[model samples]
Target: MSRRYHRKSRQFMIGDTLTIPQDKPDIEFLLRMTAVPTIDKATGADKKVIFSGHVLVTIEYVACVPDGTQPIHFVSFEQPFTGAISHRSARPDRSIHLKGLMEVQELQLVGPRQVKTSLQLKVCSVKLVRCRSPLPTHAGEA
Candidate 1:
């Protein structure tokens, strides 16, 4: 007797344009991705098919603080974001390619104590390839 097996191929793509805003005028800003994984806090067993990553945002600007008025200051922080994609499982074998572009949309100052900025984040592409192994392995064997 023999069993029937299926061979399937799936290619998922993700694309979007994001409008980001800031409270202060930043001369420059840099975004760095820290980690990418499956099953973010927002999606759990819902079949929503979501992907998430940790981003580090660094901003350089001028601000006035209680200590004194500074001409330049550097601020850095981490943020987590989630994006929807075609339903797929997050596994080691799965191939994921992510790319993004950032640009300054608008910049203004509300008052002497406050600054406003608008940023645009364009997600060029996020591609994932789903595949499976045909063999089984035991825990004790390598």
Candidate 2:
């Protein structure tokens, strides 16, 4: 009689290493980091859904300058991730909607020229089913 829906959420971790160019100034400290996730593909199976996508990570840091001034620099990179979510209502015939959220969990400096970043991606899935009801025979039929 009523519409039915199923929901599931999954979390994934993505890690990447970035190397600074020789022409760029040395990194003095990190200022801020952000990430954005994009879903590339999604597939629905018997009772599970598989997804693959990439996250764009941006890093802003203060670079050491010879002029005794702190200069801000930015670097961006893309990292790929894949994950799956299982739901009892998930099926090839039903429709599934996906939402993604990403956060920069950790950042570490491996060396003067390299940096390691850890990102957490949260994916939410909702399965929708169409509800059908019999039409009334007459306008006032109860």
Candidate 1 — which pairs collide?
A: 23-115
Model 1 per-residue lDDT at 103: 36
Q: Number of clashes in model 2?
A: 0
Per-residue lDDT of candidate 1, residues 19-130 (tens digit):
2336543333232222122222222123333445433444445555455555575554444555654433444455444443343234344444333444444332233344
Model 2 ranges with Cα > 4 A deviation: 1-6, 21-23, 127-142
Q: Mind giving the per-residue lDDT tens digits that candidate 2 earns over 1-142?
A: 4232334878778897888778778888888877777777666778888878777777888998889789899988888888989877776665556667764368888877788988877877744353243222111000
Considering every candidate listed, which one attains the maximal lDDT? 2
In model 2, state the lDDT of residue 138: 13
How far in Å is the alpha carbon of 98 misplaced in model 1?
Answer: 1.5
